[model samples]
Target: MTRPPAKAPAKTLAPVVLIDLAVLLLAGGGLAWLVLRAQATLPYHWDWSVLPQFLAYTAEDGSWRAGRILTGVAATVRLSLWAGALALVIGTCAGLMRVSQRLFWRLCGGAYVLFVRNTPPLVLIFLFSYFLSGQLISTLGLDAAVAGLPEAQRPLAEALFGPLRQMPGFLTAILTLALIEGAYMAEIVRAGVQSVEQGQWDAAYALGFSRRQTLIRVVLPQAFRRMLPPLTGQFVSTVKDSAIVSVISIPELTFQAQELVSATYRSFEVWTLVLVLYLALNLPCSLAARWLELRLQRSDRGA
Candidate 1:
């Protein structure tokens, strides 16, 4: 027999559609009210037209180049990539340790997560950047070593990290972000690892795989597949968290926005543009994470 028309889905969405429209109308009205209030009571001038010019422009030689805002966007992207990579490594190791048989490993992982998650990030950044960073960098001579590099090689280092003189402070910023983000990531990893059934571990052991081999060859592969959604979401957090690093003079997007505001006094315009820029970077990652989660749900049902 032929199937009936699928009107039930539309019927189900009728209230949802109405609710969504209601929400949009309310938001629009609120924004309109704010604009009216700003015009009447506030000294702020809305000059959105001038904002786009800051994003990109032609250089003196007529070649296309990133402007102040775009340069900051690039810096933010670079910071997120480096910090996210390190956080993933730190988190994965800590996560594995959390599930380890040894008390020492477990304690170490717990302490890292507890300390990082509980402490205020600003305080931690100050300590790490001003005090600990100097001591550590001095011990390693990382900044001094980079500063002394020949002029020809300096640009490459700058491209990878930042200016040679600032690399030490920048490194500390990267480390602070990584260590803070890693605490949250560690929980994600721990949950992913724990989600794997005990039976899988037993099966691997019964097959004569060593503990390391069992985790690496069997459990982690399965756990990692499950972890993909949260991992993507965590990277979005990393992108947003990169903003605060600007306080340490990393010149990321927020820093650039602040500088533009200082120069132009276009406070609302600059901040609104920055908000949109951040959403542009984050929204895709959020959507992709949702898609991955949905796909995983479908696969589980099929299995």
Candidate 2:
């Protein structure tokens, strides 16, 4: 006898995903409308002669290249990359210290995190830029050393600083971003480390593993895997936070965009360009984080 026809599996549609997509599209369309409306509502007619020049950032005379916007974007990326690296190192150490058995170590780690986390990040950025960096460079004679460097060595300095020859400003911005991000990253690392079972430690110890060996061989490997998602998100946050350094005239995207608007008096046009620039840089990173999370999940499941 022939079997009855088998039914195909039903595809379940997730309502939450549809809702999220609707919200995102609505927000995007609303923002676009607002930008266009603002551009139309400008009080006076903007001179269209400079519009092409501003957009192109080059003049026929080969003298008026307004490439500071590009420079600012590059500077922002550099700051974020350095800060993210520093924060990862600092946060990992602090997190380990926080969970250590020694009371003094824990206290020190706790104090650092508490102070950084409790204070506003912007205040920290301002204080460090003006006060701490000012003192350090002066007291350490770093400025003098850089100034007194051989003419031949100036290229090395330039490579490190780019056009920013000022020692205090760049270092202050980097350290400030790192310090603020590190506090949050420390908690992330601590939680990831602690999430592993205590029995795993006991097993490693029984296998004659030293504390360091246990961490390297077993604990850290697992902890790192668990931390990847949040770590990726933190990296994107670092990129976004680098824009805050613009407050110090660090020549980041927002700063240059503001300058462009001041010069052109086309606030909407300048801001729209900057908004697109940021989306270009950040959207890829956000997508990368999502991809990494999925790959990691698949790897975890396979193992």
Candidate 3:
């Protein structure tokens, strides 16, 4: 005998979805009201047409080249990528030191986190730009070396380092961002490491694994799974913080936006476009992190 038709799963809106929709609607309404109020009070005229030219333009050869805003975005992405990699290295070392059995290592790690975490990022940027970068560059003779490179090799050198004139400023920004982000990343790494069960450590020890072997083969693997979400968050934070480098004239997105505003006197439109650009960068990251977290949780449950 044929079975009766199977029932379809019920379709229902999630509470979180409902809440998000409500929040978005309210935010849109509020923004509309604010814009209307500003239009009545301010003498400013909004011309969005000029904004596209700042993002891209056709060169004399008819090939499209990145304009001011796109150039700024590229710079920001490059800075964030370099800074994030450096921060990961610093964070991992500091995290391992924080969890080390050696007294000196622990003290060193603690001191780094304490000092960096306590300091404001802006102050660090200025201090590094003025003092650390200049001394380090001059002592290393980086400027002279770059200046002496052959024409063919200069492009490679600039790609490896940065623009010749802005090398010090760029390096200072990267170092400052890495160190600041490293402190927060250190704590996240530390927590992830410690979250591993004590039973796992005991089991590894019983199985004749050395301290190093157990951490490398056992603890870190599990800790990394847990660390993915927070690590993704820290990377996003690095992207946002890279904007601070613009204060020292690193020519990142915010800096380019500022230049555009000065030239066009279209502060509101320019800033709104920049705000959306940041959201474009960050929203994907946030969604991906959530998806990864959920997938990991499901795998754990299935296992």
Candidate 4:
């Protein structure tokens, strides 16, 4: 047993390392070429320095504070957070309805999915903004209540819901995002729930579990493990789709970027920064999903 001529670690890794380095170099070269080509024809001067001011600035007292871009990012994150939460709730319910034994519940879920999935998201945003949200706010007297809040409490309301003037718009955006994303989320949930072995249901029933108990205790847990990856993906999609609300002037990231571009005349730089900001926002969700998936896989193997 001569150790098979001592397998060299460097020899084994060299090809992979070389390939990775080659890819990086090619990407860098392509980016450089594109930049050079753009700079040649585009007369606008790049001013990356101004971007930081929009993202953060030092006040007169020298205290650092978030600037317009940072504010916009916050708004975007806030919108996505609320929208994602609501979407989950709506989607889970709709998905349950989709898989319900009752014909009426299934039909209701099916109709909702069909209508929302078939309609354009932008159109939904507008209709909800104008008709549904407006009526709800008026019926609920939300605007009046917000307006009448004590001066001290007004800031709290603004912080929670956005500028009082735009509260309706913000709520509208959230509803639209939830309804639209919920349609897709329902399908994901339905599929995940359905993917479980039918024997699992039989086993739960054999254990004298009621349907609801079986679903809540036995089915959903496993389905949830299966659903985590796609749920994370839908949340990421929610973040990106939140940008569309900018068209209705919600002052989210894209809206703020547009404002910055108009004022700074730095379309390329502003958009590039905005693009990076979005990637920064979404990349963590993607990574976390993968980590969770791996953890689940390990747990399954261990069991």
Best by TM-score: 4
Q: Rank the models by TM-score, top first.
A: 4, 3, 1, 2
lDDT score of residue 92 within candidate 3: 94
Per-residue lDDT over 145-191 for candidate 4, one digit per residue giving the tens place of the 0 to 100 score: 77788999888878887888888778888888898999999999999
Please list the residue runs of candidate 2 whose C-alpha ends up more than 4 Å from where it truly belongs after superposition: 1-8, 12-56, 59-66, 150-153
Better of 2 and 4 by TM-score: 4
Alpha carbon lDDT at 35, candidate 1 = 81
Candidate 3 structure quality by residue, lDDT tens digits, 1-303: 999999999877798799999999999999999989998998888788988898999999999998888888878887888899999999999999999999999999999999999988888888887876778878888767767878998787577655777776777788889999999999889999999999999999999999999999999999999999899999999999999988888988999999988888989888998999988888898899999889989999999
Model 3: number of backbone collisions: 0
> lDDT of model 1 at residue 201?
90
Worst 10 residues of 4 by lDDT: 1-10
Which candidate gets the maximum lDDT versus the true structure? 4
Residue-by-residue lDDT tens digits, candidate 1, 1-303: 999877664347889999999999999999999888887898766788988778988789999887789889988887898999999999999998899999999999999999999999888877787874769888988867986899899888889886667778778888889998999899999999899999999999999999999999998888987888888888999999898887778888999999999999998888988999999999988898788778877998999
Whole-model Cα lDDT of every candidate shown, in order = 0.88, 0.82, 0.89, 0.91
lDDT of 2 by residue, 14-45 (tens): 88789999999999999999867866995766
RMSD of each: 3.7, 3.6, 4.0, 3.2
Model with the higher lDDT, candidate 1 or 3: 3
CA shift at 134, candidate 4, in angstroms? 2.7
Candidate closer to the true structure by lDDT (higher is better), 2 or 3: 3
Query: How high is each candidate's TM-score?
Result: 0.86, 0.83, 0.88, 0.91
What TM-score does candidate 4 reach? 0.91
List the candidate 1 regions with Cα displacement exceeding 4 Å: 1-15, 58-65, 148-155, 295-303
